[model samples]
Target: MRLQTGANNQDKEEIKKIAEWILTVGEGTAEGNNDGATEIEIPNDVLIKSEKNHVKSIVSAIFPSIVEHLNDKGYFEDKAILVPTNEEVDSINEYVLSKIKADEHTHFSSDSVCQSEFIDEFEQALYAPEILNGFKVSGIPNHKLVLKEGVPVMLLRNIDQSNGLCNGTRLRITRLGKHVIEAEVISGNNIGYKTYIPRMKLIPSDKRIPFRFHRRQFPLVVYFAMTINKSQGQSLSTVGLYLQRPVFTHGQLYVAISRVKSKKGLKVLICDKDGKPKNTTTNVVYKEVLQKMKEDTTF
Candidate 1:
């Protein structure tokens, strides 16, 4: 944010050469009239590494030895690896989970296709338990949620309001029980707050799927890494921008880079089609949306 203008004097000329991408670093791209915001070089203060293996680079630089220091609030707090897609997020989380030298706890969800005209007994028969278990719908936990104690997860539903348990609320796993999970809130108004989460019936609102199904499972998702769009309201002190694929949506790159408190705390690794790291990546911006927003805010 301090370097929004991209202005540098002769004294700082040498430092300016280090930046390769002109990033519009500020309060996450929404605070001001960013009608046509553009940039070329990101400042050299942050660690910008170009590695072929982005997940490996991300883990090594951002969340190294996560199991050893899971109790450390600083380890998980205000620090995250940012990616382009939920698939990447899941893979990164699984990779991190695979490294933990602890007992594994796999929670299986009871998935059933709701009785409806859209799906009959024969169709339902096709959606076997194992087949339904393989389905990963948006905005719900997976059929087989494998977790370990001391892992971090985000609440997918508003379990409790007064207790600060809501959607997007982060929690650190304390005890992975057979029925319930014991976790402490690690972010928002409930930091260090202890609570229990029970299995709940969750139904996805994806209307495209003709048959409605309900998944009974813990309303949680691993928070080791999240998609760029999910990181909008989040403020992290240190962020590793893992561009496994370049962002496709409007302002995604802006939103991704702006998650960190400062450019100094941000690290970016841009990758090409072959997963080779590069210096520059695409930044999609909708000028019409920005212009409309500016017009709306004018009054």
Candidate 2:
């Protein structure tokens, strides 16, 4: 379900261009060249680059002097740097975190392997506490969480839906305490509302995993930047698509570009496999899947 139009977003011709290419590619008509490859054209004006150092350039363009604007909810509300992979997301977050010189506080979690009748002691022994601590499961926080005051972190679980502390909620750290972390909601209806986040026991929700385990940790992740997969269904005013490497999955390139509501708020950075400057990137679309769906839907 793609967004045809976004409320409060004026004039989405830029979005239309991106969406059209995605549709063309998805519908199996974009490969007009003899080489059997499709390269979506990104507008020159929106092709963001200032000489070298592309990551810093995009980060600066999205977040300028973030240290000083920690108090401003609007600063992090509409702005985000989106990456294609988790490694890039972590790199950008670290780079942004280094820019802030505030003292850091670390929060470590307790990890344990859940006892399942299907699993044996040998399997359980393999997943030691140290090994469990290092596990990076989707929708779960890390074993060690380092945070500072006024930085944005996203909620990974639905602690309170009525109060708007749901999954993917963004909040800025207002105060750090021994037992709890104080933060103000930066996204959704509860924006500017302050709340306390408590440590909770969470299990791996990712289906790709073979075993079940629990980790007692804060359900949060630093939101300076996020991966494209995680950014799905998130609406933002300004978004920087930091595609150091091109997207590898079907509709990912489309999802990344379509996140921004308005034409003026979207900026994309694309490069080749060698990491050189480039204006175009491959767009993956499974026309066979679309055809299969069409056949299934036929009356």
TM-score of 1: 0.84
Q: Once model 1 is optimally superposed onto the true structure by TM-score, how far is the C-alpha of residue 65 displaced, in angstroms?
A: 3.6
Tens digits of per-residue lDDT for model 2, 1-299: 23355433554555567667545655546655211236767778778874678888988888888778977878898678888777787788878888888889889999887766266678767877998898877678778888889899999999889999999999999999878989999899989888999999999888887778899988889988998899987988788987778888777776777777666678888777677778877777676666678999996
RMSD of 2: 3.2
- lDDT per residue (tens digit) for residues 7-120 in model 1: 457525533432223344321233333444443334345645755566777787887677679777656867788888778888999998988887899999999877654765
Minimum summed lDDT over a 10-residue window in model 2 is located at: 28-37
TM-score of each predicted structure versus truth: 0.84, 0.87
Q: How many pairs of residues collide in each model?
A: 6, 0
Looking at model 1, residue 137 earns an lDDT score of 78
Off by over 4 Å in 1: 1-47, 50-52, 116-118
